[model samples]
Target: MDRKEMECRLHERFSWLDSLDEQNSVLGLVFCKSGWYNLICEMLTEIEQVYNSKNLQLKSIDLYEIKEKYGTMQTDVGNCIPEVYEIVERYEAKSEGVCEVCGAEGSLHDIDEWLMVRCEKCFHERKRRFYKRGLIT
Candidate 1:
């Protein structure tokens, strides 16, 4: 799944994500790879269930950002319950062992100072690209 397709799925399934399309919206875009698509969807589903169970308005929660940083997933949300935070944290931590490219079992690697999680195949493919670009010798 590409970013646009994944994003469309999220927006379509979660009306609470309405803010993502607005101007001046913080983290207005999904800044991550397709590999983590299922992970993100799962996280959002759990959050939605939590809100539904508690009779909370899902739109009341503001999703500020969702991105990858330092080889893990990160979500910045506002006005959500504690369970939401916990769920995000769990998924973020889990991202460390999942490939950012192909979603296979992976480990964190630093390629020319860029931190990313990748299985051996994706890692080497990225390294090869860098070498070809003269970014690495």
Candidate 2:
């Protein structure tokens, strides 16, 4: 599914884990490429399982931000146990090998000073576009 669909699904399934005021803001959204959709879903599902097992209350946990940065997934959450953070970190590390453009095996690359994880095909395509745009040689 696309980002919008993924976001909606997350909200529908795990809305209680999110903060109240920020629910409609950009910070509340999952900000990442379509490639990481499955990874994100898996992470959240595990988190939900843990949350339910622990009997956490609605709105007690705050999933502040979910985004990609420095070629890795970054999830910012609040009012939770360390295990939650650990789960997020594990998926974040896994994202390093998954393409940000296409869900394929990939590695980190420096393109026009931007760090991103991309497979060979997506990497070369991005490079070609960058060169054409005078962003890179």
Candidate 3:
């Protein structure tokens, strides 16, 4: 899903998120893409109870999916609050190597100049399709 949709759903699930956005619209926690959103959502849902109870608020933090060579990936939480950051780290560690297109086990494959997490079969198929569409040659 897109960032706005993700944020809207997140705000709905946890009303406290809206307050965080109001507090820091500049940062306004945004998820880059599939590489991070689902995992972050799961972690945030789990931690929401404690986070709110402790009166610890998450300011606008940007979580990014870092592209690397096949099989390994990384994410940067950009110096957010310690508690929220810890959850980000946990989910991101898993997402880095997971395929972005399909849920199958994958690695960040470099097809031409593009970076994507795709299994061997999917990677080849995508490359072929891209070539046919003149997106890659």
My TM-score estimates for the predictions, one after another, are 0.90, 0.85, 0.57
TM-score of 1: 0.90
For residues 42-106, what per-residue lDDT tens digits would candidate 3 score against the true structure?
76675665556776564454544333333443445454567766665665567655666555677
What lDDT tens digits, residue by residue, belong to model 1 across residues 56-106?
999988887789988888998878889999999999999998998898999
Model 3 lDDT on a 0 to 1 scale: 0.59
Model 2 pairs whose backbones collide:
none
Better of 2 and 3 by TM-score: 2
State the weakest 10-residue window (summed lDDT) of model 1: 20-29
Report the lDDT tens digits of candidate 2 across residue range 1-137.
66677677777777674533454644347788888887887888888788788887646777877898988889988788888989989999999999987889999999877999999999999999999999886
Better of 1 and 3 by lDDT: 1
Error of 1 at 17 (Å): 1.0
Question: Which is the better candidate, 1 or 3, if ranked by TM-score?
Answer: 1
Candidate 2 Cα errors over 4 Å, as ranges:
17-27
Off by over 4 Å in 1: 20-27
Candidate 3 minimal-lDDT segment of 10 residues? 64-73
Candidate 2 TM-score, true structure as reference: 0.85
